[model samples]
Target: MTIKPIIIIPDPLLRQVSKPVERVDSDLTHLIDDMLDTMYDAPGIGLAAVQVAVPRRLLVIDVSKEGEDKQPLVFINPEIIRSSEDRSVYEEGCLSIPDYYAEVERPATVTVKHLDRLGKEQLTEADGLLATCLQHEIDHLNGVLFIDHISRLKREMVIKKFSKAAKSKVTV
Candidate 1:
């Protein structure tokens, strides 16, 4: 498995909605392995295909605590089937956005339906950090970023900061 390069913010491709996976094949499985490798290498709890410049409705997550056994999960064409009205706030971060983090409020519990690596349909009821991570990664599949959940002013500031950083790298 190869660790793919994660595309940082200010990249237009990150805003593009991902396409659904057509079928589960060897190539798709290979990509899943690579995604898992990339996510682990990133030292992040979750990652979306778009973060690696792949416009596919796929995401990998491992919300296990540090030093505990990893419980990697793959979601293809994931959709939130149900969400509780109860709200919860969690400090969220994304690999695409690097070190930036913000407390985002969302449903305390969520039921997501998606295809597994074998293409079998599965429904997962998630809560706590798992729910937050699933929501965050699923948002990526729809071309949404965690920052989009924050205030307008803060979102613009973050965009401007990353835009400036991207420009500096080009000139250097």
Candidate 2:
């Protein structure tokens, strides 16, 4: 597996809604492996395919703490089947957004249905950090970012910052 370059903020691709994966074939599995490599290299807890410039409904996450055994999960065409009424707040960050983080509120628990890496249908119930991570990544599938959940002023500030950074990168 190779570590793919993650697309940063202000990239229009990040706003594109990802298409569902038709099949979890070998190629798709390989993409998952690459995503895992990229996520680990980014040292992030979760990553979505759209963040890597692949407009597909795929994501990989490993919430394991440092020095602990890695527990990677692949979600293909994931759909949030259920969400708890209780709400929780988590300071969320994205691999695409880099150094910036903000508190976002979402359901404390959720049930997701998706295809596993091996092409098997799977349903997983998640709460706590896992639930937050799932919701964050799922937002990417819908062309939404955690920043979108924040106040418009703050969201515009973040977008402006990234936009400036992107401009500087191009000139350099």
Candidate 3:
């Protein structure tokens, strides 16, 4: 598997809705492998296909704690089937929006349906960090960012910061 370069914020592609994968073939499996590699390399808990400029409904996540064996998860064409009425807040960060973090509130529990890397249909019930990470990555698939959940002032500020950094050719 190869580590793909993650597309940063201010890239218009990040705002585009990802297309669904029609078939789960070797090529798609290979892409999943690359995504996992990229996510691990970024040392992030979750990553979406759009983040790597693939523009497909795919994501990889590993919410395992540091020093624990990594538990990698792959989601293709994932759909949130259920979400609890209860809410939880977490300080979330995204690889696309590097070095910036904000507290976002979402459902405390969620159940998602998706195709596994092996092409089998799967449903996952997640809570805590896993639930938050899943929701965040899925947002990328829908052309939404965590900042969208924050206040408009903060969102604009973040976009401005990233836009300026991009224009100045400075790493964010």
Clashing pairs in 3: none
Query: Which regions of candidate 2 are displaced past 4 Å?
Result: none
For model 1, residues 8-59, the per-residue Cα lDDT tens digits are 9999988999999999999999999999999999889899999999999999
| Cα lDDT tens digits for candidate 3, 47-94 | 999999999999999998999998999999999999999999999999
lDDT per model vs. reference: 0.94, 0.94, 0.95
Error of 3 at 63 (Å): 0.7
Please rank every candidate by TM-score, starting with the best: 1, 2, 3
Better of 2 and 3 by TM-score: 2
- Ranked by TM-score, the better of candidates 1 and 3 is 1
Question: What's the C-alpha lDDT at position 57 in model 1?
Answer: 97
Note the residue pairs that clash in candidate 1. Answer: none
- For candidate 3, the 10 contiguous residues with the lowest summed lDDT are 163-172
lDDT of 1: 0.94
Residue 76 deviation, candidate 1, in Å? 0.8
lDDT of 1 at 155: 100
Candidate 2 weakest ten by summed lDDT: 163-172
